[model samples]
Target: MNALPRREAPWAPTALRELRRPWKLATFALGLGWLLYGALNYGIADWDVGISLLMGGLTYLLASWSVGRLAQLRRPDAIGLAVALAALFAAWYCVDGVYVLYHGLAGNRMDREGNFRASLLLYFLAGMIWFYRGGLAELRRDLIRLIPRT
Candidate 1:
């Protein structure tokens, strides 16, 4: 008989291991480069740019934690679908941000009505996501129960 010894976990990576990943390190370097470029071109006086980047980074990392938790589910298709939809949302926001920033720098502003409409649309989309989160949580619970323990 060659039965393996019982282990207690569901073990995951250590914080250090996560930080040392090559992809993570590369992203960190890229982020620093972007910050350096921004400082040089936009100047250190641009609080908006700095704050925006910081907030975006925090949001991104926090969101990853949520997704990482979901990654444990047996049915991974839900995770993939969530990622795809979120990517689309992020892409739309990125394009809109670029458009707005370009116009702003060129001394033109976004049309007030259009901006308001877009804001409303974004709000609705976010609301829908908030609603969907409940279902995702329920699904996670169900899937976890379905997973057989060692």
Candidate 2:
């Protein structure tokens, strides 16, 4: 006999189910925000802008899916995916911070525009950290499960 419990109904769509998790939801939301921001600011008039936004948005969705898989199975490939995402976000944080600081300090007065950009970037970083923590906790839990019981 099958051991798994039967579902009452067909499962929700993959993206919908995965995004039920808070971390996943945050990541997805931020990604959409960026996509919309790009569309609005860049107008998608040029081929480069259109393609870049398309690719970036798709990548974010894939990353969200990876986060969900990591949470459930702690898959080996998912670990690598998480590490890559972490590195990407960390690098972005560093470069953006340096850019904002240099420009903000270059002016005699405080740069409000730089301040706004920095704040948005900080929120994005925080979302990534939150998503990373959820994956890390799942990995830790699975590792402990593998230990031989006394």
Candidate 3:
């Protein structure tokens, strides 16, 4: 009887990994480009704007580094399935962020919030996708089975 999730193609690069180098760079560029545009057009005239942009860019880079780490772990990864994983991450991040920063986010800084959210949303999504498709779930499933099932 199969008691645990089977590990298939355990060391394959996931779809998110395949897109990692490209997506990370893309998000970084996209975020920074918007930051620059806002500064020039509107004005980096506020601390929140700068802070938000910095966080967004940093997260995208962090997300990219994660993909490399997963490969080092020799995890199995996938692509089409990765999209679902990405969306899951994005949803989680957004919800968590709103929950934690609800007070601050209630202010009238939708522009900065929008810019940063776009970058962070993409970064979180990609990283989670990589983890999900890159054998992360396998590790999780195995761990879950360690518990006594009623």
Question: Each model's TM-score?
Answer: 0.30, 0.28, 0.30
Q: For model 3, how does the per-residue alpha-carbon lDDT over 1-150 read when each residue is reduced to its tens digit?
A: 122123222233542343354444564577667656765676533434444455554454345334434334434356524533554453444434432354366544444465455545665565554343324456568669989989
Clash pairs of candidate 1?
none
Off by over 4 Å in 1: 1-13, 39-49, 56-63, 72-150
Q: Write the per-residue lDDT of candidate 2 for residues 1-150, one digit (tens) a residue.
A: 112121211133634443365655665577557656764785434213333344344444443333333334434465556555654453444334433454455542434465346444643444344334334457468668989999
lDDT of 1 by residue, 38-66 (tens): 64675434323543354334333333333
Better of 1 and 3 by lDDT: 3
Q: How close is candidate 1 to the true structure, as a TM-score?
A: 0.30
lDDT for model 2: 0.44
Model 2 per-residue lDDT at 47: 17
